[model samples]
Target: MMHGRDDALDALRISDAEAQAVLRELDSVQPALPGGDGRRHRRYAYYVPGGVGLQIQGVSQTYLVRPRNISRGGIAFLHGLYLYKGTPCTLVLKTRGGERLLARGVVQQCRCVRGRIHEVRVRFVEEVDVELFVDTFAQAGDAESGPGYDGGQMLDVLDKLRDAVEDGASLDEVRKSVARLARMVAPRAPAQP
Candidate 1:
């Protein structure tokens, strides 16, 4: 789902085929020696459909980006414009719980892949736990101590709520969204033993 202003994101929006092709290429290209990939940490494919907030240091403008992959040390995202190397940036990644995780980093690489779209890599100043952004099943004593819920579903509902509010939907429509959110947060009944 493209979640930004149509005029702004249309040019940068890439089809699933394009995104997957880039990922496939990365996967097939194995480095001759360990660390030869120039990546300090292993990268995990992050194709989740969402717009990440990109704030360049000393710049007031915040652009939307489509992320491709993530790692403990950094992240790679597709943007419409070419950002200069060494330019500091912060990626605001929204969590399933509607919280934002700020990743501070500097642009390490920005290569044009397709028309008007560039793959930008940013190296974070500090390492981050990959689990924060990626949804994973929680084990016993895990920070997220419960059964995993569908992050996509949550994003969908939140989007609905946002649209309803922004469009000035009637009270009934707002109420319906509230109810849906309530049901999602409500505890489920235990299965019969």
Candidate 2:
């Protein structure tokens, strides 16, 4: 009986190979290192299962599912809904800082598990506001305040850095550009008199 259910799930499953391959490619381009912070964060994220309203392609709809886990790059969710792979959607996340963040993401893969809900993986299409989406919710650190030192500003800097690197800028050039942007955005305090 259980085997039959498993077979049914397999029949409906969407391959995750492509998604994983993309992740690997990104990793090769920029390998993320683990930090020494004592805080324990899950490689996967699971949120309270509920129906979330999503706006996609100028249409609004509700998806019934539970967010399972999230990384800096993407998210995975327990699926019972009928979302298709490559479907573009906007996730409205209510952050701990009492702010609502809108993230544009695309469904990359989906798979069904026997006696368990299906799992859907989504990759963020646009750079997310990390401070609002990750730091606030993950309790990673205190919010920083400086000239142009907001989440949006940081994302812009990251975008510039990525583009520079893709344009064949040397590693030193990339580093210098990032440093200069950081200073411009968040200058240090003036020395005490």
Candidate 3:
């Protein structure tokens, strides 16, 4: 059993050099845009080995993919073959904290980056809380605030908000917490006296 786990870990591991190269490719192709990039949320690099169970042309099959990046809106990955747009797919992603999550989406686009390697983008039916998978709080160079600003506090606020909601906090009480969350995540604005 230990050997099996180790083998799985090894399969998921990507060399630093390869990871860097993938990052470079992603950056060059999808230049970060503040707003009008046609993306509703920011994408974070989240390389991992995942299974994409998809139904294409009435055939259901699962394919192994190399996860490239993820965001609240959707996820992108590298696949070995071409997948038709709008293909119904479900991704099995293992979070940083060793939790497996299933995301259902349809293939939004598929483009070839290199020989026999296709980049497939899937748009989730519902938006996801990216922090659940990637440690966005620990990430550097936040979209709103550049480097040197840590999002640890913001994450704490979010946790509190979720807990309050789950605990059946009153509307007014939740409202106040929501406001705090907005203030923390939103870009800095002029001080309000």
Candidate 4:
């Protein structure tokens, strides 16, 4: 069984170089806001600090996480539970703009900072998800299941499609995505006689 952050990193098979990289990614903790409550002390700058959900392995319930910092590779957040290193978990980050970013990753590092709160680092499994994590744009047409579904999801999907095309997604892949989008927008379209 792993003991501390180092042991956890070892179990994850992360190289010294990778560990160093992750460590450097973390910036110095920030000071508290003036005249604000002392309980709301922020440590680091985060892309989407709070509003992140994490469900432990084999646990049905998901808990909210207070993120510390974010990087292209992974994120370090404050977790209330004792999540061991090398444990598999699902991460859900909701952008300030209200877009959802979901991904699966292993607990690369965990350390007990406070009495019960532990800072946990999770490295994403997919590179594509990492790229999309920072900028999540949902399918506007599929925002809700109903008529007159006017939302930004459609615009987001189009932007993603354009990016995929530029990034060299196969013609077949683009076709499939377009077809899916068409199906999503069908309900909103005027019915033909």
lDDT of 1 at 125: 91
* Off by more than 4 A, model 2: 1-52, 56-60, 134-193
For candidate 4, the per-residue lDDT at 20 reads: 36
Per-candidate TM-scores read: 0.56, 0.43, 0.63, 0.47
Q: Model 4, range 42-65, lDDT digits (tens) per residue?
A: 122354432367766786566666
For model 2, residues 67-162, the per-residue Cα lDDT tens digits are 444655666655445457898876655454655456678988876643344667678886453444333222322234234333544566688789
Best by TM-score: 3
For candidate 3, which ten residues in a row score worst on lDDT?
1-10
For model 2, which pairs clash? Answer: 45-68, 45-69, 46-68
Pairs in steric clash, model 4: 139-153, 140-153, 140-154
**Models sorted by lDDT, best on top:** 1, 3, 4, 2
Better of 1 and 3 by TM-score: 3
- Cα lDDT of all candidates, in order? 0.66, 0.50, 0.63, 0.54
In the range 1-193, model 1's lDDT, one tens digit per residue, is: 1122222333366665776666566547732112336656655556555457787787656777777777668888888889999998888776556666788999999999767878898999988756567632221112244433345444656887899899999999889877766655555555455
- Kindly report which residue stretches of model 1 are placed more than 4 angstroms away from their true locations once superposed: 1-38, 135-193
What TM-score would you give candidate 3 relative to the actual structure? 0.63
